[model samples]
Target chain A: MALLEIKNLHVGVEDEDIKILNGVDLTLDTGDLHAIMGPNGSGKSTLAAVLAGREEYEVLDGEILYDGEDLLELEPEERAEAGVFLAFQYPVELPGVSMTNFLKEAVNSVREARGQDELGSADFLQYMRERADMMGLNADLTKRSVNEGFSGGEKKRNEIFQLAMLEPKLAILDETDSGLDIDALKNVADGVNKLRSEDRGFLIITHYQRILDYIVPDHVHVMLDGKIVRTGDKDLALELEEHGYDWVREEAAAAA
Target chain B: MSTTALDTSVRPEDRFISAFEVNHGEALNGTNASISKQRTDAIERFAELGIPTNNLEAWKYTDISSVIDRPYTLPLAPERPSLDTDDIAPFLIDDLDAHRVVLINGRVDEVLSDIGDLPDGVVVSSLAQAGSTHPDVVEEHYGKYADFEDEALTALNTAFVQDGAFVYVPSGTVVEKPIFFLHLTATEQDLLLQPRHLFVAEDGAIARIVEAQHSLSDAQTFTNTVSESFVGEKANLEHYLIQDQGPSASQVHTRAAQQKDDSVYTTISATFTGEVVRNNVTIEADGSFCESNFYGLVVGKDDMHVDNHTFMGHVQPDCSSNELYKHVLNDESTGVFNGKVFVSRGSQRIDAYQQNDTLVLTKDAEIYTKPELEIYADDVVCSHGATTGQIDEESLFYLRSRGLSKRRARILMLQAFAQEVIDEIQLDSLEEHVAERVRTRFSSYFA
Candidate 1:
């Protein structure tokens, strides 16, 4: 069985019943890095949001199985506790709540849900300092409010720092490299590479091929109009980068 | 009893209009002629304006009918109660030298107060005594700063103005210690007391004053007070008003502070009592480069009602104003906040900001907040925002999921929300005291 499997997922917002994700099917096994590249409004981010259990979108139909468990049945925080993490494209800022406090709360929450002992304050601080340094984040950033007054690059690096701290089994990077510079992009990619394990998997969503050069994926899928039109090896990213998406659209129309 | 006749003609016995006229007529013969004239003019204005109803924009949410239903008993030849310094020792602040002025049943208890240490050129005395000795100073600025035309409570306080404190800081002088004014009301019968305060800080002078209102008995009483502060050029004044009366009491207080060139005025108000309470604070920047800071925190539980109205006017150029008011309502309590800032046409380079935020813990609790800014100056920056909502559910859940019980999570979030406002208080001891009281009140909710 696949480590993460989605069979005909259909989702949309509550107020407007217009579907954003119409029957999207994908599968990824452990230790695999898969990139889903698509144009704007092609439901790329919707898939990542649905996998992370964002309440704004309603799952009208379908099944999302994570390690033989129904992922759709869990709450967002519960899904987070179940080793599923989504690096938001736009991170929410919480004023008056320090970054260290937020990470400690998130980490201890997952640990408590899994019937594991919580880390002490000293140990948690030491762990956060190490992960923060690895992500090229200053220790002072952890003392300030979470994501408040942070530059775009610093915000992205902070996301990866949280990813390293939580150590989710299945991570979804939703346009994580959109606003990052070359150096910040390398730092984030290095943080993701450090977290790669045999029991872990990643679903990288992006609109550009520049990030692919830093963190190469094993498989690349082209998503068009809420469905994966084609799937190929890492060379497909290079092909799309060189030939653009119009050729894939014509081929997908012919195949359909 | 004719409806049309009653509406057309202004009668001297009308409940709303007559209350002021009667009190003013009696106060003309009092010891202070300047205060007396000011009261007379204020009463005439009160008759024209009448008591504000719900239709009035400023008094929309808070209705004063319950307290104004019957005539308040004005104390007559009230005996001075015997009280010692030991009686008020618990309320004193350590490490600061303070002059204590105690008022018992709205009358000054001169025998019990301590006026020992005094800086040169500084004068502190009873308002009645000061009226006789310093008539020129009294005539110059007494009651001239308060607007009795529109405010009925100010008119009422002027109409029945009895005994209160008077403090005068000379030019270029700084009072190293805070002056404490304790207003204690103890009555067997339902009474209405109007306590007046006139404070003047001359040019480049600095002083700190704290006023506390408390009651000895749980009797039903109505206390209407007006405190007017005048700050001279380049002077600094810090004023604190703390209202913690009994649960059976009701109070309406109007405080106004006038600022001159380059002067700074700061006011912090904390209200934690009264079955019904309403406070109106107004600050006018009448000189260039003046600054004002207004901060308030209110906690209401059960069926208590607390209303706050604040107005800051920037009439001169290069002035700044900042205001923040926070409320925590629980049970069936209700809170109202109306904050307004006005920048005149020629008042360029003025900066003003106001914010009112409230948190309702229960469905029955209600809060109405309206924050507005009226700016005519093109070069000025003014903004006002008001928000009323419950605590953030995600933050609460995040806390609860981390081994903290549901109750602990709620307490932590509520404390954190209130801590923002508490942190703005510059006095560390007072801030800690207020925080402790807030925590104690919050703990009762869980019980």
Candidate 2:
């Protein structure tokens, strides 16, 4: 059985028929790391947004199934509680909310849903400190407001830091390597890699092949013109990086 | 002061005039000759001023014309009303090791008060008792800092002032614990409570004062409270006022202070819930090297009106002042903030900063803010700013994305915005107590 299965997914901007995702079909199995590579505006990020249930995206047709249950029936928060995480391309900044407070609430919210007790301050602090250490973040960032005045790399790192603390079963990385330098990308990839397990699945979306060198995925899917034109092993990513996106575009156009 | 009698065409004004005439003789029984003269002068001035309306620039946002529309018998008597202290116990700071002064309907309640041992020369008593005991001190400071002639509410308080807490700290003495004033209103019918409080910190003295206002009944209440603080040379004073207007409450508060050379004063006013509430605070820096810090937060919903007016006068050179006022409005709640900083001539190197920030939770909620700065000194740095906005959509989405319900996310963000100001409270227990109150207040919004 698949961890996540998307059949005939057709999505577009709300209140308009301008489609972004046209009958896209995909599936992710347990213990599989899938990478979606595409050029700008290739509907890569739109897939991530639709999967996260953003209000601006209207899912006109299709069904999203997670672990054999209809995922589209859940709210964004419910999706999050059901172990779907989208590592935002650009993490939002909350001016007055401290990182520790946000992480505590997030962890407690998920924990309570799973019939687990809320973490006490002492235990929570220890839990957070251990996770934060994996991302090379200090307890200091936990004290500061969440990503407020943080550098570009620091913002991405904070997202991965949240990813580490949440430990979601199916994580979605939407351009998580967009603005990161080599060191920061390695930091984020290392943080995500540390959380990978046999029971977990990940969907890594990127426009560049730079991040694939670190957290190599088992399956690589090429998206072009609102559709996945090709699918193969990790070698397809290297092939696309070497050959560029012309062949994928030609193939998608010819098929259309 | 204008002595011309105001046309008592306004029904509430007429009632007030009749009440003043009826209570004049008995109310002046214990006051000294000087205070008696001040009282008579204040009442006469109030008769001329009547109730201030938005026509006056200072009262533009808040119109007290409707505040006195209903007939309310004034709580002018000195008798303590009966109340269940247990029911009102939640308003008190549980472990606060401070001197407690309780007032029931504008009259001091000595039975419920706890005035622990104090250092010599540090006297805490009722305003009337203080006047009787320290005539010169009372004569020198009472009704002086308060601009009763111009403010009808202050004048009204001065006219029929009976009993409020009074604290006097002699030179070089430091009161270890805060002097807490727990003012409770316990009238079921429509009533008005006017309390007059005075604090005098002598040269090099230090004092901490905390005031909380609560009500016992669900009846309509109008409270007009006036408090004046006189900080002598190099003295320090800290004051905090929290209004928990219980069940159809309306309140008007005037807090004024005078700071001498090198003296410092910090004051905070927070309005948690009320039907109609307004606070006016004025600080006069009379000598060089003085410092003043002012902070305020007002939160309300459902046809509630909360207004705050603050003025900082830099009458001395080399002084610094900072002020921050924030309002969070939800569900048809309206808020108003008017702040002014005046740096007079020859007050060089005066640094003043004023900021007003408002957050509107719903589309129906509204907020109006005015930050005014008048700098006549060439070497002064004076700045004022005002910001009005709704909660950031991105921030809300971020919180909601992490498994928090929309309601929980909103409450958390609102708490964060309010806690920033509460964090400025220097007192430890007081800070925690205020944070808890703030959290509970936000909780009631969802409730």
Top-scoring candidate (lDDT): 2
**Residue pairs with clashing backbones, model 1:** none
DockQ of candidate 2, scored on C-alphas against the true complex (2 decimals): 0.63
Which runs in model 2 stand beyond 4 Å of their true positions? A239-247, A254-256, B1-10, B83-88, B378-380
Q: lDDT tens string, model 2, B113-210?
A: 88989999888988888878988888889888988868988987888777788999999999989999998888666777788889999999998999
DockQ of each: 0.10, 0.63
Q: What shift in Å separates residue A142 of candidate 2 from its native position after superposition? A: 2.2
Relative to the unseen true structure, what is the C-alpha lDDT of residue B78 in candidate 2, on a scale of 0 to 100? 62
Q: What are the chain B TM-scores of all models? A: 0.91, 0.95
Candidate 1 residue-wise lDDT, B286-387, digit = tens? 999999999988888888889999999899999999898888899888999999898899999998988898989899999989887888999998878878
Worst 10 residues of 1 chain B by lDDT: B1-10
True-vs-predicted CA distance for residue B152, candidate 1, Å = 2.1
lDDT of 2 by residue, A156-234 (tens): 8888888888878899999999988888989888887888889899999999888999988999999887888899999
